[model samples]
Target: MKESSVASTNMAFTDCMTPTELPAEKNGMRMKNWRNRIGLFLKPNLSKHTKNRSHRPSSDDLNQWAQSFDKLLSHKYGKAFFLIFSKSEFCEENIEFWTACEDLKTITSHAKLASKANSMYEEFIRDEAPKEINLDFHTKNAITQSLHDLSASSFLAAQLKVYSLMENNSYPRFIHSDLYRGLCVTSTAEEP
Candidate 1:
């Protein structure tokens, strides 16, 4: 056989053999094989950038809305209801303001509180804001004063007002609407 044919046959045979049997000094092939084996076990199975959706409320949570306003707002279905209800002109800002306040409260870093507070005021409180919420002058002034001190509760009063508005106004309309009624039917059907 030609020299090339003999080399090809040897290459094919070696490729079929296990890495452990290969020489440690052969281009550090043994280390490469061990590293790959270890890497698989060391690497995490989960994606770093994926958001956790486990916070979504169960069907039981939806059924308990009549028990308390707090229960309703905390549930994921409450967010869904608000999103649909906000489709009316001038109504979307209420939900937006409440959501911004919710997000603001999650920030634990002291340095971030001031900046987030300022942005929230600009977007939801200041006159002629792009998405100005229905804040009375008293609530707006309180928020403006709180911005100087900058805490998680800086938007509390305004948030509470909007939350009350939603609870008393949009929420009743939502409960009486077809969308909410459909969700109720679907949730009941899903229960075993």
Candidate 2:
């Protein structure tokens, strides 16, 4: 089978594995090991439960979706829309990397920043990383250099590059996707 298909299958299987089936070990070693191996590859799907469902876009969101990539990215519904669209394209790693970087910026502790920087680089920047994102040589080299200092801005260059890639490349396709159209129709039908 193709790589994408295998990934999809693994994701499906992993999703179906309930918490009960993967009980925590007395020493936490088993759980830690399991998380290290599987968590890097398969992110839990956020769209499965009703509570986790993407917010239906408002008219303002719809208008902004057509107007600016920045606006679309600012709204949760828009983020969710792009995430679903990126998954279809098998390039969800770009958005995931972008999102991780955004989260990384909130860290105030030097120790936390150091740990997270290493983890992010290993997962998204290293060659053959599980969730390796596409990055130009300059951005990649910048990230490499930033790792030595491990500041909050360590991933900024690569993050911006991935964000621009999604905005320029995936965002257009998402706007044209049937999923986006369906969301528009559903949101429109719900308006009073």
**Clashing pairs for predicted structure model 1, backbone only:** none
- Model 1 has how many clashing residue pairs? 0
**Shift in Å, residue 175, candidate 2:** 0.7
lDDT of all predictions, in order shown?
Answer: 0.64, 0.69
In Å, residue 79's CA in model 2 sits off its true spot by 0.7
Candidate 2 local lDDT, 1-192, one digit each (tens): 996676557544332222223336532553344335434223333433345323356656877997898888778867766775565555778788888898899999999888988999999998899988877678888888888878888888788877777776777777876566665665565555
List candidate 1 stretches off by more than 4 Å: 1-59, 88-90
Q: Candidate 1: global Cα-lDDT?
A: 0.64
Worst 10 residues of 1 by lDDT: 13-22
RMSD of each: 23.7, 11.7
The lDDT leader among the candidates is 2
**Model 1 misses residue 179 by how many Å?**
0.5
